[model samples]
Target: MKKIILSASLAFILFTNLKADAQIKLSDIFKKVTEKQSTTSTTGTPSSLEIGQGIKEALQLGVSAGADRLSAKDGFLGNLAVKILMPPEAQKVEKTLRSIGLNSLCDNVIVSLNRAAEDAAKEAKPIFISAIKQMTLADASNILLGNNDAATSYFKRVTTAQLLQKFSPIVTNSLSKVNASKYYSDLTTQYNRLPLVKPVSTDLTGYVTQKAIDGLFIEVAKEELKIRGNINSRSTTLLQKVFGYADKKKG
Candidate 1:
């Protein structure tokens, strides 16, 4: 009877302790969950705003470097990775011209296309900077935890339309400045005049605008890769702090 009584008391105490411990654990879990749901990541890492700032600085570097390189003479024409060429739709035109010994005209058209892209690239910095300023905390967090080109992809997705709108006039002016239209007109006029060949259109503004944007993004991606992969590219304390977290998370 004594043993039975002792066992009952022990069980009662155990039950009470278990209840208390469960309550404490539950409280701690709730606290942690609350903190997790907060708008920023501030535990042992930079805050979301700081991350956003770092990203902007990084993108600024990327955009500035890319735009500067591409704005230089032969920036696109010389760089095979991003050189603008005859559109696929116009491939037949190029072939026909080349076959007829109009290779110089084809060459001029290709050069002008690259030149227009280079001319429009110089104006991309301010637009990209403005877009970076509007990045949300969610965007910062996602980018912080994302792959090397993730930020670049996000910028492209958000800014492509605006960039198109902005790049149009610059490209248009560039085409005129470099006489790209005249060269294209010459190509099409010759091609259409040939018997048994389908008529080709002369306007290339839409194609140039799209291709130039694509080339710019390619350059931006290269800069992003450098920033993510190279310590030297993290040019500021904010970048160091934010990217440090990214490295840890990546590992």
Candidate 2:
């Protein structure tokens, strides 16, 4: 009886231990499955969201860097891609005045106009950064999926009016500082002195503002194209991957 009871008790203990071990293994499997499900649920939808965000961040940084590059001392003067040229409307006055032997003054006015544009570009960096920070997921996705210059176009569309308003005063001040006003006045005096010519009048500030904005967009487009076409220009891994996807779509 003692042997029988002892054997029965040993069997019971072994069976209980085996059952406990099996339960632990089952619990571990359930934990792994639950963890995987949670991870999948959390990550699946948000990955696309993150990709869109990353592209926008890349574009914004690219614009800021590009603007900074252009705002330096030789930014406008050095970069042929973005150098400000005289407006066509003002060309007639410049040509007529030069024809009347006031070529030096005409040259001065043209140079001063470009100088004012360069000075006004200094103000654009901060404004552009502000606009960049305001970009949304929808905006990002659109920019990513759109044409090469789409990001720049979106910036121009949203910020051009506000930028114009902000730029006018700065351009006016720059023009005055650069003696553009005096140059314009001298040119106008020479132009009006021309016999049988209509009075040569133009809004120096407004024209400079518009021209400066146009030049900035040109630079932005150049940067955008670089980022799209040149792998080296895409600084970050995310940018490379995202834009690489774009390149594949184009292909």
Candidate 3:
């Protein structure tokens, strides 16, 4: 009877050990499956933050490149799209002055306006970079999803007021330094000498400031359009992919 009890006890102990080992094996398999699932999830897609950051980086790069192009020699002069043209209000005066043999002074005024624009554009790079850096997720989304000039428009909207404040004075100083005021004075004197037309006075600084801003926006729009339409202009896989998504949505 005692020998029989001993054998039964051994069998029970063996069964318990087997059951424990099986449970441990099953737990290990479950852990491995959980770990694999976690790895897949992590690798499968980017987080929202990551996506936002990528968009911001693309915008910043675009802005930097675009601004650099604008600041280069003959950048505005070479690009007809953004070339500084005579203001409509001043055009009449310009023509009248030129017709009366003040052509040299008219040319000087035009050249000085463009020069002021060029000088003020130098200050735009930092402002543009700062604005790009401050881009929020909403801003990024709008830029990514809006029209071809959306990004340019966004920058214009956000930076215009501040840019004008910062740029106007510089433009004023540039014009004065380049003797634009004298040229205008000479032209106006010539115009006033005309008996048919009334003596007209205008603010050279304000007119030039507005024109400079307009020219900058025109160039930025061109850059934005290039990026939107030309894959080669993207310059990066992220830009291509993000803008590709935007194009797809449009189509």
Candidate 4:
């Protein structure tokens, strides 16, 4: 009778141990499933607002950087890639002036043109930021996946008309303030006076305005690339999350 009792006790304890182990295994499996679902919900896909906001944020940063760089002294002059040279229509005038002893005058005109551009660049910040504010959800998606300069191109394409309207007047004012008008007038006057040279009447304000816009786009592209490729350049959590999706997709 004692042997029978002992056997029964052993069987009960064994069954309890087995049941506990099975419960533990089931709990671990459930825990793993829950963890996976949480991760998927959090990191699966970026929403439309996230996409639009991220793009706007990136563009705003790019515009700020571009405007700040170009508006400062030496911004246009020092940046060879975006430097304002003599307009194509006025190239002959520059050549003729350089051929003569008017190199000093030509140099002066170049410096003043760049100065005017730099001065006008400050005004571009608000105009560009305003344009960025108007970006649609559709535009944001294309820009996010676009090439290195895609965002810049989008910016230039959409805002150019308005930019021209606003920037032209500012460039006109800047031309006089920076003495670019005077220098260009002097250059052309000297060039026309020389023998066997065609009369040149390039629109100095228009030329500088166009060149400054181009320079801004270039700078913005660079800023965009910096933020896209470099982790450190993404300063905000939104930036991190938005661009993190891009990185995963690219990979």
Error of 2 at 105 (Å): 1.2
For candidate 1, lDDT tens digit of each residue in 1-251?
99999999999999999999999999999999887755244335777778888877888888889888988999899999899889887898999889989999999999999999988888888888887788887887887789878888897888899989989998999998999999999888899899998888845888988888888889999998898888887876678778877888898
Q: For candidate 3, give the lDDT of residue 205.
A: 77
Q: Per-residue lDDT tens digits of candidate 3, residues 1-251?
A: 99999999999999999999999999999999988876554233344554466567766667666667666766665667666656676678888777768788887887777777778888887888888788887878777778778888888888899888988899889889989888878777877887888777877777877776777777677777877788787676556556666777788
Badly placed stretches (over 4 Å) of model 4 are 1-44
Which residue segments of model 3 deviate by more than 4 Å?
Answer: 1-47
Question: Compared to the true structure, candidate 4 yields what TM-score?
Answer: 0.79
Candidates' TM-scores?
0.79, 0.76, 0.76, 0.79
Per-residue lDDT over 1-251 for candidate 4, one digit per residue giving the tens place of the 0 to 100 score: 99999999999999999999999999999999998876654354688899899889988988898899999999999999999999897888898879868898888889988988898888889988988899999888888777777788888888888878878988898888878898889888887887886788987778888998989888988998898899898877677777888888878
* Candidates' RMSD to native: 15.2, 7.7, 9.1, 8.4
What value of lDDT does candidate 4 attain over all alpha carbons?
A: 0.86
* Cα distance off (Å), candidate 4, residue 109: 0.4
- Candidate 4's clash total is 0
Q: Pairing residues by index, what is the TM-score of model 1? A: 0.79
Clash pairs, model 1 backbone: none
How displaced is residue 164 in candidate 1, in Å?
Answer: 1.0
State in Å the error of residue 135, model 2.
1.3
What lDDT does the true structure give each of the candidates? 0.86, 0.77, 0.76, 0.86
Worst 10-residue lDDT window for candidate 3 reads 41-50
